[model samples]
Target: MFKEWARSVRYASKFHRKQEIVTFMRQIDDLEIYANLSKFLCDNYRQALKILKSEPELKRWMSVEGIDDYDTFHVWLEEEREYLMGMEDGLPKKREETVEMEYVKRLKNLESSQGRLSSILKAERAALSDRADFNPAPISQVACRHAVEHRNRDAELVQDLEVRLGITQQWTSESPEWILAEKSIMDHRYLDALDEIERIIVERLFEMTKIHQSGTRYKMRRHIAKALQARSKAIRNAIDRYNTVAEEMDPPKPTLSWEEVVNYGFLAEFDILRDTGDSIRSRPWTRRSYRVAMDRYFKILRAKEEIQRLNIEIKRVVTWIEDEDWFLRRKEAEYKDLNPPLAVQISRYRQRRARSDYNHMQRFWALAKTPGFTGSVVPGVSVERQQARHAERASRPQTSREMEMEVVDERERWNSSQEGEWEDDDDEGEEAEQEKVSTLMYQMSVLAVDQDDGRTHQLD
Candidate 1:
């Protein structure tokens, strides 16, 4: 109190005690600054009274901290008066005419800065505590409830945005992992806009993997499997497309040197066994390993029906040829035992056809599946992959909507705060509007009440 008394005495001394009074009206300069100062004072009056020494910890208490126009003389006056009331006429309202002129100046400033200040304007409503003949605007009880509803809704929206922002942070942290995983299968570069899509894809993959490992392995089993399969197919097809394009890219157009092939910008010209060792196809064990791998690959292929038919024909031919050799020798001496000569001739022709087919089949597969010629077509392989490729080629990348942007646009439209929008439209009563908990809740309640009230009023 003594310190405050001493400070006041000094402040009083700084001003001239003149008889003229000068009417000393410089325009308030910034009405926003005044409005802001009043709010800061009312908000932080108690904090200044209990000022602490630690600068960092006392930031909120000090005028330098948080958001408020600390430089404004009006704000400084307010901080003092807030904790110490009846402390003179308290930050005198600028002389009426000058205050009006300053307000006009600030009003004009709003035109260019409206978009920037939209959030600030809506947010400033919470700081209104001055009801002393300055009844800012007529806010009715019904309107107050609506304002509260709006505030609550806005709070929820802010909280949701905050949560999403946190999620975005977590997503950003894991983005490199997503980039790596996507690159593994996609062979594509990164896009900032695609962060959401990439995160979702990685998260989906993780979830699918999780589901596969979890006991939900049984509940909705088919649905989960289908989702996983769909994603896997998309990735595989994307890879296949990449490989196809890569193959058509001139096959690297290698400028092979006498000593080595140059790959990856480096001259790996010092391979010890480049020309000395047998190729994988010529080596016996290497040949066997390839055949084993090829068998597994073909079996896994779904549309191998045509290849299976060819295999059946080969098997039938081989079986017929084996028995016919013995049958023909036995029949040569036992012609009298034959039911019909025509039937016997037919049987002989079948045996000859079988022998010819077996040799023909061997030659076809010799080049195709042979170990040394592994670059050729896979023998007896199904056409499923070719069909799938055709199907994939028919589709293309599709566009999706930005739902967050859409939601924001909706909120902005509703939040426009038109001059008289809060006026009650209800013919029933303002009392009814005052009681709603949420707008969404209110809407539902209205419909429910209308239905119930209709029935009750008819009976009454």
Candidate 2:
């Protein structure tokens, strides 16, 4: 009877200990989930703050929705993150009976606190979601959610809609309308004129290329080219309008010289010279004509600079697209194998955005390539004089090595003259004259040494 009682007590103790361990593990899993949720909420809060700070209009909208004081909200989020991190760090590692009990109690308290915080976060997220203009989630997250919710819909159409929606969101987020509103009427008109020019150039290019490649189509091609030249008059008119507006807004000050405005007369050698002939010096130049010439000259310089900038931007965008394409392609192949619907949708959306950006850049390149759209002729001047002046400036000795060589040559000349003087000096005053010469030479050597030291420091 005693043996059976002891066996029963042992069995009961084992079962109870197993039950305790199982409960402890369940608490651990729950705490881990709570920690993850806390991290997620913190990230969302951070993203929200970033969005609000960037968009003042959105902040106003949110204020209307009763979520004012982002600074306080940001502080609260930071505090919550730190509190959760502390909780995680303070969790017990040892599995002693006393430590386990203490850990369980702590976890229970943490659970209650986390539950309350989670509820608050959920309510805050709901408030943000209620505002149509404010979405804290990234483009990918939004697209993924949409894809998951509407998996039964047409995949391609859904993807396209997501891309369009993303673009609309981006456009609104940038608030270009506000930016345009800040510009003057003249600026708006100038932009419209530029758009018209771009449209004309694109149409002309399309018309010229629409014909088949054959000998029979030669006349058609010629007709198209001639017709496009007719549009050149329209282009010229638009450019005149643009120039008038630009000159008004940026008017050339009297202090600016022709060389300063026209990149040292390099631009004068172009089509401008053809239109004005060699009459720049011969004509009775008035202030009005000077201002007009300065405007056209500056426009040419601006166009050249813009073209170079656009080329660099295009190259950078192309490189970015290539890298993005490689990454998305790999992601897409993985998605195909795994058949993860949301991942596939997100990848497609990214690819669409990249393609759209590339097309936009290419259009910009086309617009930049169109000539005679920026401005008309620079005042004609003597190209030979300009060339000679530019050449003289270029040929001037400006390098450190050249300066050093000049200094060495001067020192050699001085030394040779001193030697000749010494050879001619009489013995009576020779000692005194030699001392003076030595003193002068020492000073020159000291200066040379100082200059050499300065040059060495500059190199270093």
All candidates' TM-scores? 0.19, 0.18
Candidate 2 matches the true fold with a TM-score of 0.18
Per-residue lDDT of model 2, residues 78-98, tens digit only: 553453344353331222233
Which ranges of candidate 2 are over 4 A from the true structure? 1-286, 335-339, 354-358, 361-460
Show where candidate 1 strays beyond 4 Å: 1-141, 149-196, 199-320, 327-336, 351-355, 361-460
| Tens-digit per-residue lDDT, 1-460, candidate 1 | 3354354345443444231123221122222332243233222322322221232332343334243432332443354334234213323112122322332233333332443344445544545544334343555444555555655555455445446444333222145643344332221211111222222334344455667675765767677777766765554444344335434333221122211211211111222212222231133212333234323333323223433443344434433433443245334324524544643564455444434433433443332222211111112212543353345457843212123223323433433332123334442133123222223332443355346435544654
Q: In candidate 2, residue 19 scores what lDDT? A: 75
Clashes (N, CA, C under 3 Å) per candidate? 0, 0
lDDT agreement of model 2 with the native: 0.43
C-alpha local distance difference test of each model: 0.35, 0.43
